[model samples]
Target: VESILDKENFTLEELLDEEEIIQECKALNKLVLLDAHYVLNSLMFSLRDRAQVEQLLRYIVEEPSEDDDSKRTFKFPFIACEIFTCEIDVILKTLIEDEEFMNLLFSFLEPNRSHSALLAGYFSKTHQEVLRQLVDLIGITSIMEVLVRLVGADDHVYPNFLDVMQWLADSNLLEMIVDKLNPSCPPEVHGNAAETLCAITRNAPSALATKLSSPSFVARIFGHALEDSHSKYGLVHSLSVCISLLDPKRSAIASPLMHYFRNQHMYEPPIPVNPETINAMLPKLGDLLMLLNVSSDEKILPTTYGELRPPLGKHRLKIVEFIAVLLRTGNEAAEKELVGSGTIQRVLDLFFEYPYNNALHHHVESIILSCLESKNDAILDHLLHKCDLIGRFLQTEKQPILSGDNNLPTLPAAGKHAPRAGNIGHITRISNKLVQLGSSNSCIQAYLQ
Candidate 1:
């Protein structure tokens, strides 16, 4: 076999003429159904006719309408996997156009907990037309399977998978991934999946609110993400994603997200809770306070069978409160390190900056105000300081002020519907702070008063 295929001395045209090439592919395709390893090993041997080789390979795995007995006859999935994997680029590019081929590829690839790299590699190398074909043919169900596979693997393909997931017009795949964080996965997967989900929402938020009402999957994903395991990466991400997904327009999700905020918990080592998640959710601080009430031992809470603690670890919740504490009152270092580490910005971008058109702004403001009322000077101090900083930037900074003309909020003519006074008042007061400290170096004083 090696001697036959190694005869690359022949030109591409010559190889096409060789009857042996066709015979070999037929033989290999027939036997491939019997023993995948044989073909997988032979894959390294350069086939004389690469095109025909690829076509014959696609035949065994991709042919549609195979009877159960025929499926049994072929010992597929594994064989399909071997082919898809052997010349990953070739298989993906060739089969992607054929709906049946694409379905077979996804079915075989979907179950593996670590196909992310392979899928990503295909996306990276394959032509755009082929990629579009793959995604279009992959379908929502298989796409979800791909998400699950990628998340489970937690492979290097995360970014590539992210690129494709972002282009999806449907939210089922996103919901499926986010939902798993709550319970289907352990703490790490919850957090990692959350970060990926948050990124998706960030890139396409308009698409996000469209599906926020149905967040059963999100609840589960974030529920588990709230844990503070040894690795806080995922937990922090889960926290961020949860906040991003909240939309007062989707009152159902808003309430649940608020519940999530109220139910903050921590994970021990192996799954550390990220302090940043707390800071980003700070604008919704009321939810944190509510969670404290929910977790309190004073009232008897409902328990599941053999329930030990509320699913979220007790210490983990304490950690969450600690983060809330930082959001409310941490020093510049805490903000610089945690909140400033892009987490808070992300939250603000989703809830405060964008999507307010649908009532999300009120929920965000309500959360922040509730946190300000915590009576914990630390929590109150940090928030007040941040708001002051934001106001000063908007009021005095020539860039923000000039830019406002193009991006300013347009109010209704007179009183068709007055905007919320609370938000207006908060801005007014913050602006006042900025005004009082016009030229002097008194940011702290402005924040303090």
Candidate 2:
């Protein structure tokens, strides 16, 4: 043991020699074959030269494989991880200023690359002060790609990545991400850009809110994306960001969609939401809702299918929740737009389709409750008559009320109100208010009665 220790105890000068250290690193089959700490110390000492640092970073970013002509496969990334684990500040200070080194690190973010995890981990440990400097050199898109890869590549939780995400938000990277979500961009690029925005809004919501204080930029970008049929891949993630940002309790920022819905009449030419876009998105949202309301029986399949499916429950719930937020905002124009767009009917269809989903029931009920509470005669008339929403509710209860009966029939308590009794009571109270408001003429009262 003493002899082995003695052999490993090389002086810093000997280890720092570029050719000698590279040869030693190349000789190792695995990073564990050498003393990682010693290799890291040597690399740090050799990082004074910009060319050497870039060279070392390039080596670290590439993975070891037999097919490569360059036989250098020492797992320098593993050594870099060791350095990051111990002296990230020192190494970042040395490399962060080097545009070439930063670009080399950014280059590893290509989706096909295997070493992204290591680079992500390295950047994850880097101090914000040092990381902020690399923002310009690395560019926002590259930084977002790095973050998207970091979150996607590893199953393990990385709390440090949250700090990096916050820094990005504070540095105003949202607009860049939104800009990248263009129809012309590749699906993967759009997906990454959208995913990055979702992650930032989720992990650093307050920072994102502060950065997106006006909401116009994000709104316009998402609106355009939402209107484009080719952007389906990006739309899901963009919707997620919208959901997070518009959450009144969780998000401090107001959504531009919400604003648009509230004041759409103010625009000369209304936003053109193509029927094609609506048709494409509505079903996706509906399918997500149905998937969320999956029965317990759905979880146990008889066959060992090609692969077990992931529960679409959460995403489904998220879509409904987003709609619920819009309704709860009490924006009359928004509510009217939703009704006109058939979103209200779709939500009702989902509500009736999934009878046993408590979460779905709650969100759908909230939308109803918001509409009733708005007390806008036009809106209420639309809900009660035009959409025949009350008839749908009666159908859901399976109890048809007579047109002129003074007494309402006893609704079945079991399926009718088991998961949503409060919703029933809310409807009853609102129906009475509508009757008093005179919007409930004989035609409307017939459904409520």
* Best prediction by lDDT: 2
TM-score of 2: 0.42
lDDT agreement of model 1 with the native: 0.39
For each candidate, the alpha-carbon lDDT, in order, equals 0.39, 0.48
lDDT by residue for model 1 (231-294), tens: 4455545555554543222222334345445533421111122344333444443333334332
lDDT of 2 by residue, 1-449 (tens): 12222464543323333344444433332344235556544444444445555554655566656875433444454444334334233455456544455545645544555644645655444333334433322334565455444332221333343443345555435565576666666666665665555554444334454454244655555564455643455555556556554442333233433443443343222122223322333333433333333334233212121111222244455567667765665555566667666677666655554444456666676666566656466666667777787566556456422122112111223223223322454345444555664464554455566
Q: Which ten residues in a row have the lowest lDDT in candidate 2?
A: 300-309
* TM per candidate: 0.31, 0.42
Any runs in candidate 1 off by more than 4 Å, and if so which?
1-42, 45-82, 85-172, 179-192, 203-213, 227-231, 247-449
- Enumerate residue pairs that collide in model 2: 261-334, 288-316, 292-313
